[model samples]
Target: MSAVYDTRRQSIALSIVVPIFNEEEALPALAERLRPILDGCGEPYEVLAVDDGSTDRTPRLLEDLRTAWDQLRIVTLRRNSGHQAALTAGLHRSRGAYVISIDADLQDPPEVIPDMLTLARADGLDIVYGIRVDRSTDTGFKRRTAAVYYWLMRRLAGSFVPAQAGDFRLLSRPVVETLKTLPDQQQIYRLLIPSLGFPSGRITYQRAERVAGTTKYPVHKMVLLAFDSITSFSAAPLRLATAMGAFSLVVCLAFLVWALTVYATGRTLPGWTSLIITVLFFGAVQLFCLGMLGEYVARIYTAVQARPTYGVARDTDEEQQ
Candidate 1:
């Protein structure tokens, strides 16, 4: 009774990839909501629950849920390779005409998926995004920061990542295949998706609070995710760093010329104050450029190694095979 049966003969129309990380508390509720919507869609679909090395009972819960649903499949990563890596793993493993990715925390509702699919079909879009309409549940600081981040990303990245759109979205088989061919270690799925240049649409919905489980994406992790998204997609930061260094150098040289001219003209004396200021400013600029260059170089080094994005600790599909 292998779950990994060849689907060429009987084409699977849909697959839902739910990346779980320590979501033990929300498993039952998630299943209860998802199963009915998936079943009612009238398209053959499978749910791939990617367990991103949960330390809690999330793995055990996924096993039990798989037993309850015939189309449910599980992929367990060896360790926490991160949310984006886990998502990429699930996308690669899925076999369906269309694939939808969502959070296991139940914040993204499964009920809206049918609408997304319908819109995709009607509009001939390769991808459909779920955009959050309301962030009332989030803190004011978080809400404002998210707004600022999205605005900056749109302006700087040269990619129109829709405001308030998360990883919860649907992709056609062609889009999924195209996505699989991308080979980057530091993946930013949201940013990369738009670069495909496929016809896309968005569905707006209010984002609800997590049904259960502790929030896995804390402030620090959120900041890192933002950095990863920006750095992975656009060279704008690196380019800005270069421009800044050039500007600083020019300013320093201009000041030196002015100071030397003043000395020559007997207008002022060469003193520590001006020299100290110039030194400090140049030193800060150099450090900033070094940091920016290091970020890009680190990403290149990671890609050169070509390590698999994630490892599988235990797979229900593997056992069935």
Candidate 2:
């Protein structure tokens, strides 16, 4: 009994997974803030920093920190595989009873982690998300757009996705295991986490602006994320295409009936304009439907190829071991 107890205790108390890109400036500050919190918890914890092919000194900085902090573990991907894939890599590699994922930008605030941990423990919840109560630092346009996006996602996805929720969240071991079972290569963790039917809650915090390094999620990445999120979770776009096709067929039938009535009454009028308009309209609709169909087909093709989601360029910890 004592041997089994000791083995369980050494497995892992907690693991914090931070996916880093060119975040050289923020890495030290993040470590400084997080180290104390983990120490305060009176439990053994390790920080897994997954560097996703950073072009800057981010990899070197992580190595220096690892030397100073024995609890630090680093994983370097072969190339830039985007944020979600990086997070997935870390989660799979982590060995912890509880795992928490956060951005390295420092905007998510490491201080809120304890609160999330507390909530997870008190409620016996499998997942606890850090929800942003306010985003005053964000531009007005961004704030409004985010609100609309969340609203639309909830309506279309038919899932209770908490508003203002980002990747900063805590998950129990069960939740982490369930996440690994999901094999979708697109990797939308935010939407996929809530669908596991686990008891969950939220910790509200005010979001702060980034302290260093440029925003990794620029306009282009934001657009891609929006597209992936919408396409992965909902069939609303495909359904809309179907509805449009039916509506167009009805309109064509109405036009045919009108033409027959005109001929029966012996009213000969130049119908070239109406005929041209109909042709263009239907042509546009067909192209639009085909485009939508192509998007789904492309996704399917990518999945069937079964490519490795990411490759590891270098791993310092693995070498040390």
Candidate 3:
């Protein structure tokens, strides 16, 4: 049966939104693998391929594909907003009962879509996360860092947050609507979705290597994403600053006792070395805390200013279909 909103209004079963950067070479293979699975879902669907100001031939490639595949809708941003902004654009533009966001590299299988749709329909879930069951394909650095990032995120973002779930996931219309209403200047949907406390389910899959082209997310981008994830969702960094201050107090007490003992014993020694070491250590800790606090303040400043996260220059045929 087709996914329907109600008997009256026309609504698509799924809207798969793929964020693209300079991925011209990967576009064709991604489409070839993803389209058939979507068609076989036995429901009306739309693929929102959002172009994040690609400098390569990606824009032209998407345009050419649109003529052949009517369901392939394209949304071109005015400038290269980062991956998350592109996702926000696609999310806002999508009109479907359930929305799924994935990368254009085809690392996450399109085949999982059918099963996700089924589970959502059957169990009445608000969200279904595509959990990575295996990541043997990833490098040792990636695997180790991913583990640490998720571990830290779970502690800070609460226990409901999934460990291995990336951007690949399905969200019901209600969840989508909620996300649109949130005033998140930097969007991280993994944390954003869990914060809602929706009735969510999980579907496991093996993470594969890229189908073609280079990965859009480099080391720098990954680090940025991790930073956003931490600062956006939780105020743990601010709290950590408080902890650091407490530790600094304890150290000061210990130093004071030592100074008193040295004075009482009439064994006064030159304290330039001790003083210098103490100053450097405390200064470093204080600066690190300040930096962490600054990150949060920067986000707050951006939010209060109320800036638009992204702007769309054009869309494929008005995105109505």
lDDT of 1 at 268: 92
* Residues 1-321 of candidate 3: C-alpha lDDT, one tens digit per residue: 122423312567789999999998999999899988987877878889999999999999998988878678889999998888999998887888999999998789988999998999999999999999899998999999999999999999888889999999999999989889988476888888888989999999999999888877789988988888888888888898899989998998999999999999999999999999999989988998999988978887998999888888888646443
Rank the candidate models, highest TM-score first. Answer: 3, 2, 1
lDDT of 2 at 27: 85
lDDT of 2 by residue, 126-211 (tens): 99988989999988978887888788878887658887898999999998898788774858878888877899999999999997
On TM-score, who's better, 1 or 3?
Answer: 3
- Residue-pair clashes per candidate: 1, 1, 0
- Measured against the true structure, the TM-scores of the candidates, in listed sequence, are 0.92, 0.93, 0.94
Query: In candidate 2, what residue range of length 10 has the lowest lDDT sum?
Result: 1-10
In model 3, which runs have C-alpha deviations exceeding 4 angstroms? 1-10, 319-321
Which residue pairs show backbone clashes in model 3?
none
Best by TM-score: 3
